[model samples]
Target chain A: MKIMPCPLNGPRNISEFVHGGEVRDMPNPTTCTDREWAEYVFYSDNQAGIVTEWWLHAASGYWFIAERHTVTDEIIRTYDPSEIFNQRVEFSDETTAKEVGA
Target chain B: MSATSPESLSKRSFVYRQLAGASFRDIAGGAMATGVAEGNNNRSQAEQSALLDLSVLPRTGFRGLTAAAHLQAAGLPIPARPNQASVTGSGELVLRLSQKEFWLLGALSDSGAGVDALNQRGLPAADCYSLYCQDSHAWLALTGAHLPATLAKVCGVDLREASFPLGSIAQTSVARVNVVIVHHQLAGVPCFSILCDSAAAEYLWESLLDAMGEFGGEVIGSNALL
Candidate 1:
């Protein structure tokens, strides 16, 4: 089997990944209704072209979005959903500005 | 960490805190060429009877009371492989889940005899990515009311039974030693049987001791943890 780089899991051998149908776009769940919601949740585009999809990095225990060409598992780009949500939090442990001023 | 039920979700009863930084030891597939081998045999058969201490046994090793052992299902995680089921033999239990795999439970010492039986039945060792994991290395199942809390100090996995359930098993680093977390519970208490690199045992033991302090747990040697 030929080895290729996957966005996640660093450099795992190609054999480890199974071709999960065509990766496609997802509609916003909050705004969608009825068939649109059903389609968004239950259907797959399964097309053969540049597409953005969700891939399960089974070995590495990560799930992320990938932009790739359907015909070739050649991924165009990858982004970590967790990283996007990982904004730095600043906690206010102890210090009240009003009290200090007064 | 929630204030009221911090222990439930903080993942830090003690040893469970390492879940974030732990390098998971993947127990799937066959073991490396060089792995843990304590000794092939211990001469005293009489001692063999008492060699194992089941008090600390995980739900998996507690399996000793039962005649059942593991039946390996190697090369099975293959996507297209169908009808692959999980069961046990008299030696060891091996199974695959999602993209991961596990070694059910077995007696490390008596493993060869079990493998010999499988070989006698015409199944070759090379048939699948199979190893009598019991013979593959030294394993200790640290199960108790405070097991997950005790293990948190040295391990990195989230040992919550809700997340890492009884069937869950993974090969990951503990106390910096490579090990497989064999998920097993005892009387509703979550526990793990850790498999490690043989030479790394001392480090793991010390780590376990350091983590077990808060629970008023005393240090137990391998003989005790057995």
Candidate 2:
């Protein structure tokens, strides 16, 4: 059985998973031109090398990113999206100073 | 008649008559053993296991970043992680399906309440999520020894006692039907509570019986389970 290691559910059959499309950054829709939006939706790299993509575990509905070699189809590693796309909240010096009643 | 909810659509299981209709009766021994290959009995045997229909129970589901806090407000403890189920003293089962999703099974309140209690307690935060009366799934409990062996025929995960001890849940496919299997002990007997989509309930039920036939399995009533 070809096993895909799920970050949460552990290794399971490949059949239990669904391949999400390639991971790409979303251009700011309000600022980008129409052509850029079209390209984002309609283009593909499909390169034959190590690439990052999204995968969903069918049973649990858990989604994670997998880095795999295109030619060998071997998964290099799998990780949760939060590892890379973590949304950080930085408190400015002004805000902190005001909170302390400066 | 007009379209009925999935819960009221099927009053009994497909094999209810075959199992003698809510009675403590057993199907013919080895009833499904003819087609399976021989020597399959050496691995395990199923006993005192019965399949009961629990579709009539009230079920409500909710999920969001604040779901745990909402449940705690309702006086139910928040399960720490995925696949963990906590049963309240009142016999309500809360299963944490994922980081943000949870399914509340059985009655949520002592008044035999439906979804109101869930919505009421989860308020203010209720705007953050919605409580759904999920009639889409069929529920059953399989209790006995060798549950792992029987489940192995359909699911790919290891369900043995050591690997999948008590209080763990598995959201996996069984007989090609998406289902949630919760490990629990009923009356001190090992039991696995399975919930699957109502559309494929009959097919999954039959498949489970076929898998257990080689081990001398029989179907009993809910009385034996509760």
lDDT of 2 by residue, A1-102 (tens): 799999877888898899998888878555568799788898878999999999998888899999999999999999998888888555467656654783
Give the clashing residue pairs of candidate 2, or none: none
* Model 1 chain B lDDT-worst window of ten: B26-35
Tens-place lDDT per residue, model 1, A16-47, is 44444434444544344669966766777777
Misplaced by over 4 Å in model 1 are A1-102, B1-92, B95-104, B107-116, B124-136, B186-190, B219-226
Q: Estimate how well candidate 1 is docked, as a DockQ score.
A: 0.03
Per-model TM values vs. the true structure? 0.39, 0.78
RMSD of 1: 21.6
DockQ for each model: 0.03, 0.48
lDDT of 2 by residue, B93-188 (tens): 789988888888763123225334665563543534754535577776676786898899888889898989888898887877778899976556
